[model samples]
Target chain A: MASVRNLLVFRQLFHKETSTYTYLLACKQTMKAVLIDPVLDCVERDLKLLRELGVQLVYGINTHVHADHITGTGKLKQALPDCKSVLGSKSGGRADIFVDQSERLKFGNLMLECRSTPGHTNGCTTFVLHDRAMAFTGDALLVRGCGRTDFQQGSPSTLYESVHSQILSLPKHYKLYPAHDYKGFSVTTVEEELAHNTRLTKSKEEFIKIMDNLNLPYPKRIDESLPANLICGVTDPVSS
Target chain B: MASVRNLLVFRQLFHKETSTYTYLLACKQTMKAVLIDPVLDCVERDLKLLRELGVQLVYGINTHVHADHITGTGKLKQALPDCKSVLGSKSGGRADIFVDQSERLKFGNLMLECRSTPGHTNGCTTFVLHDRAMAFTGDALLVRGCGRTDFQQGSPSTLYESVHSQILSLPKHYKLYPAHDYKGFSVTTVEEELAHNTRLTKSKEEFIKIMDNLNLPYPKRIDESLPANLICGVTDPVSS
Candidate 1:
């Protein structure tokens, strides 16, 4: 663990109420870091931890515009003047930098490859480090289940294509980090998701049928969250 | 419980991740209900429950401006056209109706007496059902503790005075309902709090010391939640 800490300082933080996961990745030498899928509620906590570790934050990367929680990007940028906010190119005009597939976001000596995965939301992106050491799947891919495709311009067909072509195509050992999990398991491998993912393993039609019948309730914060998130997290300028 | 249900068709709903509580109080005769401290995520579930119970929602009332989650008042109004959004008068003209102390919110043969309970926030209100049958204490008083007075216009002296005069002054058996409780207990009595509340039992100076040293992490959703809540949970009119 100590040796790995030196290789790439990584930390997975959890917001217990929303079951959201935020990943922090830092280059050990330069202490330059970026947070992925940050929850607005934990900005102070995240910033405090970064300060304690002597890391200067560079970016707050949202996997997509989330429905369940608000993003911390605006607040983070307010606190740290140098830190930029990143999202997928299709995320409208929300963040500071929006990258497309195959694009890379570099922080110090570390680099994360962006892959377009638009199923759960039209702008969902998977961020993977060099050599596929880890892939931050956001909500498109979860532990055993995937994100519900009932709303937010989500489609089963698009998700199936994205997960299969973009995620499973990688080496079997690439570690998977999801934005959320309710069952408490963390960090599944591409090999394991290939074998055990209840949603992704089914045929495309079956997957579609399953998603269609999920009858999931609407996310509570969607109304307020969606409107605020459309312009990144700077919501003070929101209009009714 | 069934007998009590007959008296007032009450339901205590819990949002597990954040430990926030929302209370539904409906009058059996008119089948009209009011929700206190409604979370944004549970609006659909709450509305569905109202549908199943054959009750029409009348008011979506908040105890105070929440930091952890978005309020459901705006969404509820959108879903049920007749429902009104209620908040404290000091809420800066954010809610549909600004209620002051001693104001009566009546529906179907039921009435809740609103009492100004400041300190947690300048606008915090405690609603007392007819004849002091129950008191929604909100953050001013928790099950065994109280809301942290470090932010959101919180003050230990104000909270202490509010608790003793506005809350603790009620009969010993007046059941207490709070906006949040991490310990999983649903309800507590004024008598129970008088004996067990860690903060209220202390002297005013000691209580202030305890609140000052909490050193709790800033709530994750404060930035988004505060701004959105200040406008009665309507962030759609939000601008960048």
Candidate 2:
């Protein structure tokens, strides 16, 4: 186990337009970094911040193929020659690296254990940094709210199982960072979610009914976001 | 000094309408808590979170008398009978407790050292929790930006000196949490602000010039917010 010396450099960046969160994490000692769920519109801002922090970008990883905004991973690769675009193997999104369940991705001295947490989408993955007790849960589990399992191969039963097994099962104190938050909440703990998650705390059948009854409007940007995201947000849609 | 055992329980709550950040800090061992810069619009949400956390409300502190939005201190005091409304002595606002520069306010086992960082507003203050290397900079220093010094006794020269002497003087790695963020930035470090703060990084003259030329529109809520905030956001305007 690593000593409690605070070896990780972390920053949470937000995209106001889509209410998306992009995280930048770097290994302090090696200056190797990864950007989780970067947005296409804020790549310049993210890049400037990365440069100011003086960290080298190793990977631009997305938690899933988003339905609201395009990913910045492709544009990031174009800017950072050494950066790779990463996504879950089941995500069906083209990327430089396709991570699978239980795969451990390494950067500097830090290791991210990727847990396949599908149901919000089959490719939704939560990256857990066990040493720090932090998990970047894409849309599988949100603060007090879980993702809508209404589109893109979403299944309420599967999402419920994935969250309970892969995310909620983590240590209670683990800090969970979600992909998007409309409210002003920045982070939530597994402990808090366990006690307060509006939907997931109910019986599985109740959860299914709740998911089914959500009368949400179709995502406004779905048409544009889905296609662009599938090709890793590149206009030309070419694999690296 | 306390041992490094992660003793403080922290949560950053946001008000979307005003772009205000209300921070909740609690002593894990004592279960005593304080909310810094709470917004009037989110009192229900804040109270619910406090109840869920199982912490006793010690103080509801505002960093200043805001013009953009009303403070939640008054409403919080009404909701949490034991909670006191707190503000800077210079704020000229009615509050249960008036703190001044260099005063240490205690909540359970945690101590917040108050530093007056005026210029954004005469009463604008920054609360530093030295043990955790965290500073709640209320509208004084922002991420790559500083509060506009053009209203309510706002002086560019004073703001520059206040920031350089009080906030920027903190340890370089100390995380700075601002009261409001228009952009999606949640927090910044002292080091980053020193290096990249567009206004503060410049000379006093340049900063003054920048502040002078910034033809920002009049604050829409100032007329309503100023009067209500002066009495700590109570419609009745009575101090507890």
Candidate 3:
């Protein structure tokens, strides 16, 4: 078993088409790794990256049920036989393992603390690595902007509460990595989000107004992604 | 009713994420149109374009079952009550309407001739319009490079034969429109494809070798796209 602090491998990968950020984490000694918020369109790229790093994928984790794109967890689970698929219990009860907020997922001697962050979607979860070094904030929080709360069971008040207590309460240095970003911005810290977040900087009332006024078009593949994601991206024998 | 040559409304729309070219053809006088290879992700964009152009969507057509992206035909049918979905009978029996080679599709006063171009897929069809003024050659023919015939029931000899008899036999000045193109190059003429297509210009044996050695990875969303597209992008209540 590898010590959690000794050797950690973390790579943040971006899928240009969808502007999605997939995180790869591994323990050097065990060669076991975990992937977070994988996109269906970038599976080969992710697999190639794992091969180059000489790591064996063991877990596929989802921050939430994404609306803009299909999750690659199902595909990864099929490709890597030993890999287990995981998502929050609130996230529609799909995946091989449905985890709750207090549950910590362990892989190669390292553990990820799952925190309920259900604003962007009813099942969104933020995963905190050992000692709160970094957090995967899914759509709940972005660098300078928070996820839009206009649809998919989203509530502006709930998002504000989730971010303030569950995320902002962490030590200011803890890094915040979000699942999607359209602009070229990278990771941000709790301190920076607290000070500079465009949406979070506003009061709760203002945040609600902003959410109501966004008027953004529904995501491109929402119709296809939602239907396929509900079944974990596998063929429905009867449907065909 | 508009004359076929005097009042043709054709717009080639591009989906940047997938680099797919969706063609919208209409009779300007009747304001009736049909869309070819409509992408699921761009349904809203397509609908908006139709509304802006003040044309009534009468049909959504597929050149074949796509592996790269989900078709928007199913969603378009739901949005536009009058729209009908069409595909080649060999592609699968999922679409609302299926026609074989020699069938002419009519919308308003214009008609498109269906020609079998099966090499990339068993059901691939090339559509010719207005005395072969233009043709939508799906994956059978590309601009500077023809589609790779390594999978999906592909055969180099079949592609060569099909292109020669159905596409190349047309007028030299006929415009060639492909379903998808990664490079920026757009419509090419039959004469240009005969001269410049890297794959088609080769002999049958040489073309087979090129396809075998191309070594392209399987599409990222094949698993999800294939199953969903097989059923015309409709939601399977049982699966979901």
Candidate 4:
């Protein structure tokens, strides 16, 4: 078996009480790594973890323009000027690299293949580390339910298609890492999500109907979250 | 049996997704009315209801400075320019008539006795319609739980004191009308609240411990809602 490496998950609670999760994937042998969906203040803790793990931060990737918490990508980039900030081309944010669907990202011995999901938002993406049999599904496929599709250009049908065609098609054993979870339970699998997720388990039409019935009121922080998220969690510099 | 007027409860879903409940209490014979925690946009509908019921809108009261939706007190004042905007003095917002603990506000045949219940905020108040055997408890008390004490300068101990001293002291038969509830179930009695409310039923120390354990994250719209609520729910200058 290939040598085991330490993967650290940093979860940060943000904004009026919302929880955000950030992941650090590293290969012990080469000490190269990538981060996903990181919160701004948690970057310091992540850097500390990186130093202790003897890992070199190489890339930062955001799944989408999150509507709950500020992204830490820009701040991380500022701290580690050499590291590249990467995101899906449709993210409409400033990034070192605008990745497209099926784009493979390498970190020493590890590989993360980006898959466009686009259900919760117009530009949502899930990164699959094929070799490790792991997939960071972000907000696309949550444990028991699905991300809401009532705001930020979210389409229930499109999300359903993204889940079935893009995420579910992956290896059944691939471990899923979502963005936010109240319970400490961190990981699940494609098979589990397909079977238990109330939102993803339904037929596309049924999913739409279910989503329609579960029509939640607009997110309380949408106006505040979207503007910051659209800029990849960076507030525009105000002129003095 | 004394002639009874059916007690009516109003639930108004407001903001992009947040729900707010406003109530209208009326004496069927005298046609006098009192408004509780009114959301601005729903004022017109409430006025229409009052017209249909032949009730005069005499007083407007707010539960607290809401962090989800704007209050309709100012709007109602504009519609009925002579109507009094009544509220607790601690609300930190301007009102035509500031009420204090046990202060009885008379409206023709109905009487609303103010009860200071500071826990959700320093100024939160509940209105007891004494003669009708009803009380508008607002966020301080919910069916199975109490208003969270982690926001807007909330204190668990203060909440405990308010519950024990102000609310629980009321007569067992007094019905409760909260400012927000989605289940369409309205009106819980003082006896029910004292017995069933998880937050209120605990001993002072136990209640504090439970609240401490709750350490809830902030409300989603707090940043947006506070400014509006601070101004008595007026986002802009009142239009004549």
**Residue-level error in angstroms, candidate 2, position A163:** 0.3
The window of 10 residues in a row where model 4 chain A has the poorest summed lDDT is A7-16
Clashes of each: 16, 0, 0, 5
The global C-alpha lDDT for each of the candidates, from Candidate 1 onward, is 0.83, 0.91, 0.81, 0.72
Q: Which run of 10 residues does model 1 chain A get worst, by summed lDDT?
A: A1-10
Task: Tell me how far the alpha carbon of residue B184 in candidate 3 is from the true structure, in angstroms, after superposition.
Answer: 0.3
- Candidate 3, residue B129: CA error in Å? 0.6
RMSD of 1: 16.8
> lDDT score, residue A27, model 3?
79
TM-score of chain A of each: 0.95, 0.96, 0.94, 0.89
Q: In TM-score terms, which candidate is top?
A: 2
Compute each candidate's TM-score over C-alphas: 0.51, 0.97, 0.50, 0.48
Model 1, stretches more than 4 Å misplaced? A1-5, A237-240, B1-240
- Model 1, B94-128: lDDT tens digits are 88888999999997778899999999898999999
In CAPRI terms, model 1 is classed as: incorrect
Error of 2 at B6 (Å): 1.4
**Cα lDDT of model 3 overall?**
0.81
Colliding residue pairs in candidate 2: none
